[model samples]
Target: MRDVAREAGVALRTVSRVVNGESNVNAEMAGRVHSTIARLGYRPDERARQLRRGSSQTIGAALRGTGGMWEHTAEHTARAAGFMTLAASTEDDPALYAQVIESLCQRRVDGLMVEPIGAATPYLVAEVEAGLPVVAVDRPLEDVPADSVVSDNAGGIRAAVEHLLARGHREIAYIGDSERIYTGRLRAEAFRSCLQEAGLAVEDASVTTGEAGPEMVADALDRMRRCSAPPTALVTGNNVISWQVLRQLGPAIGELAVFCFDSLENAELLAHPVSTVNQDLEGLGRTAVDLLLARLAEPERERQHIILPVSLSIRASSEVPPPPRARRRRAHKAQAPSS
Candidate 1:
């Protein structure tokens, strides 16, 4: 307290007033003291006890977007539980994520909710062990054994493939995000397994993955279309890729059977009623908050890894039969060897 007061050029009582949430201190002075406290990594010795006892009553949420639906739902739930939510965006950058987390830590937040982006997070190991309740949303922490909430990636992909297969899509092509991402890799792998189970071969033209940019998606579509055994149906990895493939297909979107893995807005309103696999974003938020609050209430409880289910909606886009010309090509080529 004395060090903070000395550095902020404020009296000791003012620092105490700021920390204790007492009034009469100027807002500017309070802000300065807060900054100094974060810079000095100042934490009260018994913050663990204070937070568990509901003394500080604040938790930090580090996500991709602070105003997203998941974040908003979480804030509402936390407020209902008598806890204030402090949210920040990670911008999917590792360094920025670290800084935001550090600031949250300096403020001595009771818990943390994060939509992890980076490949690994080593700095969180010590914090978790020190009685900090951390809940990972969407993706699990690479280096820590903390509670996490994630969607069923493999199951969602399987549902998409199964739905397409039942509709007579023998040669189905998949275009999705780069395999470097966790969901991307898992979905791609699941698509391959689906092919093998159906006694179909997995080939490059059948599975394309790269950065999810407009040009990249367009190029992938072109390559798949040019192949000798081009796909009669297409399955996109996520919502963004699904939209890109739709745009790239243009008038041809009506020609190919399409199935999208992640959720898409107004899917039935399109030229062809597009099939989709939708994740429960609201459920994810609610479950994550419930898990975090449970951990806060019982710090010694076992960590939980919860996987929510996804639903697949079948529509005209994916329910259509394979193009006759493409099916004929496959049959003719198969008989050519004996001929």
Candidate 2:
């Protein structure tokens, strides 16, 4: 502080105010202080200051994927609220999840917002009891108590099913993530229910899940098409599965009505504009931060779970019906006698 004050030709208190981003510091003085700090390669001792104040004013985020828009949005929202943010990817690994959470706790962050990867987190119970506010995003923590923000997975599946059904699609197959995952399970189950309600068969080969490689997705498509009654439409569980399915389906993609549970980045630009059940990612990110901050302010507040709605964005792919030739081929194959 003293070095910065001397270099910027300002009092130590002025340097402190500028470093803390206090409104009382004039713009010109603050600029000078920032420039001097940059030239001197001086970084604030945030930990030491936090210890003195008994508040770290920082938030940690544990996300499912390696990196994406969710992490960026959450970090930006927290920073805008005057809080420092740190993030790590769990990659759906239980050990990694524990390690990341422990590291963040060691740093004494004010709270955490995590896209939970596994079923149980009994370890987090003690941490929450110790006054660390934890908010779960995308999926809720089963073993530990925490606030949560999630898109309506079941509702999204219902919307997708409705969209395809309205387009006269009866035989709709699904390719999804492993049902062991929360989001995947909800979506797959919802799809099955929708089919059953419409008196359509949920063929074993028509609803495939577990892995999402190109080969795996291609195999699912082949299985559905090879069946005695091929599906005329399809629904994908999430963005990763959706993209792979689209790639594997290729020129044949337009032959079937397709709806994905989650929206993709370049969906609108695809050769066949992909219809999707769109989750409000930005809203989910902002809500997680707001929930964590609220819990921090009132430690005694009840645990909250926010489920945002999803909407279907129609496009060329989902609204289209099966090609006449494709339908005829399937009908003739079904009617043919066994050799």
Candidate 3:
């Protein structure tokens, strides 16, 4: 700080204010300090300063995939509050997740917003204990007592199921991502609950959950088709599953009732537009940033777990009613004879 101030011909306090992201420094002096900083290859001691003061004016984001709208919204919100966002994708790997978080901590980012995957992160809990402000987004960190913002997975599944049931579909099948994922597990459980509440037996074949792959989906569909009473409706666990199922079904998309758990853009352009339960991505992102900021402001506040509400977007696909019972039976019988 002293060296930069001397080079820029400014007071040490002015250099401190500029380096710490404090407001009210003169624009010209601040500019000169920044120019000196650039010329001298000077970098502030962020970790030491963060220990005395409370911030690095930067946030580290550990996201599940490539930073999308969720990351963009979070970045924008944080920037508005004078924080820069640094992000890295976990790619759904535990080793990668751990490495990313550790690397961010080393950079002394003021806080973290993570889209958790894989398993419980006790490593993250240690950071929180040491005064790192952390917020979970999309999914909560298992066993970590951090504020989280996520969608109502159960509610979304309920909406889809009720819509199909109202459309006269008794048998519904589901294809989901791996049960290891938080969203996939919650959604699968929700689907079973919906069926049981409606007085329907839970058929193991009616739901297939594992890591999503075309082979797994095709086999699940084949098994459902072979049921004594085949499903007339399908509720996919997420947008990826919905599209995978659609790709396999091809021309059959319009014939079967389908409800996807996530929103699809330009869905109306399809032969049969998919109905969806929309998760507010922007809201989730912004809320996560706000929560992290609040945490930074008052580190002693009680932790909050927020579940944002979801809305249904009905389209052509889910409105398709169940095939008539006679036709269903005949189709089964005809296939049986050939087999």
Candidate 4:
């Protein structure tokens, strides 16, 4: 900054104003300062700027688990954008989520990017109403209207169902997350719609919805396997559920074709790579940051909901052979004519 000021023949205050995008620096002066900054390759100290501004150059990102792949990716992406991040997991608990939000607020974070687990709390609504920039990640609140960055869950599920159908699967099982979450509900609706459109009976007995933990997924897979006529293909709602299903049905995995809503960490390295609908976590993080910063820049701007598209990754686990009925039967010769 000092180098930039010296080069631009401006005082330190003038440089600060230009860098912070503050008015009062005339267009000519601002352009000169910007040119000097570019020539000198001068980078402002974000920490010093935050201290001067009396607000942390930090953004709070609330997620489900600290160690989860998605959370790690989001954190890395946020930090890369010149903002520190305060991360916490709600563990799917409303009270915990509220507590984390309050704690982050006390720290005076500039904005929040949350992967909401439970329904929107009163405090969350109040904070947003009071002009705090809040952008929901992955899942949006049911009752609250706020900016959201999420994937096209319905479209992804529809594509997965279509893939299974194309592979000659009629009895397809769906293991979904609890309907309390927006992603889960949308994916479920899509799965049902695709089945109906294909003129295939959606067997209620084969559709299971609840928490998508490993244990829950294992139980769901077990129940599906025990059905009188087991489904030939399975579609899991999320990555965690997919992992559990794979773990439970390890060696016998080839019997049932599988596709999941989200990709697993080691998906590419797996012995039998599982097909998945991949969500762009880094893109989602960057988009949420963009929205929050935009809101901070212009508070009266109309709220926006951004839905990123998901892509299907076809792999070995989803490539099940056609059923016996679909194969041509061997012709039998009639020996009775000779007799």
Candidate 5:
């Protein structure tokens, strides 16, 4: 900054104003200061600027779990964007979520990005109503008015179902999350609609919804197999459930086609690579930042819900053939000819 001031022929205060984006300097002086700073490769101290401007230079993110793959990726993305992330998980509990939100608000974070635990918490609704800049990531708050960035769950699930149908799979099963989250509900609805459109009925016994633990997924798979007519293809709601199902199915994965909402990190290593509806994690993180920044810039703008498109990754897991039918018996006319 001193070098920039000297090069621009301006006082230290004038250079500071230009760098902080404060008004008062003439256009020509501002341009000179910017040019000098660029040429000298001088970068402002963001921490100092935050302290001087009363900004935190920090953002709070509420994740589902610390060990989860998605949360780790989100944290890396946030750090790469030059923002400090204060992360907390609610374990899908509303009370825990409320407590976390209160703590983040008391700390006065510049903004917040959250994957809401349930439908819509009263605390979250109040926060948005109070003009806080909040961005919903992955799972949206249904009743709360806030900027949201989420993958196209419905479209992605529909594509998966269609792919299975194209492979001659008439009996398809679905395993999803607890319908408490918006993404789960959307994907489940899409699965049903796609099956109906294809003139196939979604049997109640074939659909399973619950926690995504390994034991739970194993039980669900067992139930599906016990059905009078088992499904030849299955669509999992998200990554966790997909892994659980895969572990239980093991080598027999080829017998039942599979599709999932989100892709795993080492998806290629599977015996039969599982197909997935891939979400751009980096893009989603950047988009959440963009929304929060926009809200910070203009608070009175209308709330926006930005839906990012999900791409279908076709793989061997979704390539199973339909079940074979019983062959008809040959006529017994040979006995008469012999007589």
Candidate 6:
């Protein structure tokens, strides 16, 4: 504190006032103190301060991946609620996720917002029971009783399938992430259900889920196309797979009507504007923060799950069916007449 006073050329008391966020300090003095603190790389001992204040007033967010609109909104919302935000990426690794959560628990964050990865997180239940409010985002953590804010994965898939089927497509296929993940599983299952409801056969070759690599997408495409009656349309489970499938198949994309389960930034820029089910990702982020803050205020409140609806952005992609080779071949056979 004395060093900060000396660096800012202010009295020790003035520096203390600024560090403690006392608004009485003049703006000029506060600015100088903050600038000096920045130049000197100064960070207050939050643990010591929390001990004196009886609460840390900080929240930690453990996410599968980081740096999206959702993370930005959550951090901003927490700040607006007078809580410091701490975030860490779990990289979708179970052990790493547990480690990060444990570290945050040790810091005594007021609460946690997690984008759970694995199917189970039994270890976190104890933390919740111990009064650490937790809210899950994007997907629910199986077997864990926590408030969650997620987009409607099944409904989104249903919208995509119904749109394609209404467009006169009998054969529709899907390519997505591995079903080990919650979102992927819901989407794949919903798509299969939609096909069955329409009295259409659920061809195993039509549903492919694995790593979103070029080879994986290419192989799936090849398998779907090799069937006796290839799919006339395709629905990609997510934006990542959507682009990979589009790029891998290239001109063949025109041959198959496409509907992506998630929207992409440059979707409209393509030669053919791609249709998509736009998830309310930003809403997901804001609602997550809202739920976490609510849980922090009332830790004993019943857990809540908010599922945001997804909408379809109809574009040229799924509106017009391309000329499949099989159709052209059948046309040629018809033209040949008597054999």
Q: Rate the local accuracy (lDDT) of all candidates.
A: 0.85, 0.86, 0.90, 0.82, 0.81, 0.87
* TM-scores for every candidate against the unseen true structure: 0.80, 0.87, 0.89, 0.79, 0.79, 0.84
Clashing pairs in 6: none
Error of 5 at 338 (Å): 38
Q: Distance (Å) between predicted and true CA of 83, model 1?
A: 1.5
Instruction: Rank by lDDT, highest first.
Output: 3, 6, 2, 1, 4, 5
* Residue pairs that clash (backbone atoms under 3 angstroms), model 3: none
- As a whole number from 0 to 100, the lDDT of residue 9 in candidate 1 is 94
Q: Tell me how far the alpha carbon of residue 66 in candidate 4 is from the true structure, in angstroms, after superposition.
A: 2.6
Question: Across residues 1-339, which tens digit of lDDT does each residue of candidate 5 receive?
Answer: 888889899999999999887899999999999989889999999778878987786788877666554556556665776568888887778788888888898777888988887745777767777778999888677777888888888989988998888888888999998776677788888888998998988788667887678877887887776666677789999888998888888898988889888987778777799899998776687788878878988999988888888898888888878666321012222222453
Backbone collision tally, model 2: 0
| Count of clashing residue pairs in every prediction | 0, 0, 0, 0, 0, 0
lDDT of each residue in 3-86, candidate 3, tens digit only: 998999999999989987788998999899999999999998867877877567899999888757888999999999989999
For TM-score, the strongest prediction is 3
lDDT of candidate 5 at residue 287, scale 0 to 100: 84
Tens-place lDDT per residue, model 2, 165-278, is 877877789999888888888888999999999898888988998866788788898788777777888999988899998888889888788898888888899889999999
> What residue runs in model 6 are displaced by over 4 Å at the alpha carbon?
1-45, 322-339
Evaluated against the true structure, the overall lDDT of model 3 is 0.90
Ranking by TM-score: 3, 2, 6, 1, 5, 4
Question: What is the clash tally of candidate 4?
Answer: 0
Per-residue CA lDDT of model 6 for 1-339, tens digit only, reads: 778899899999998788888899999999999999999988988777788777889989998888988898888888888888899999888889989998998888888899988647777889988888888999997877899999999999999899998888888889998998889999999999999999999988999998678888889988886776777899999888998987887876776789998888888888878999998878987898889888877888888999999898999889976456677557546645385
Residue pairs with backbone atoms closer than 3 Å in model 5 (clashes): none
Model 5 regions more than 4 Å off = 1-54, 66-83, 327-339
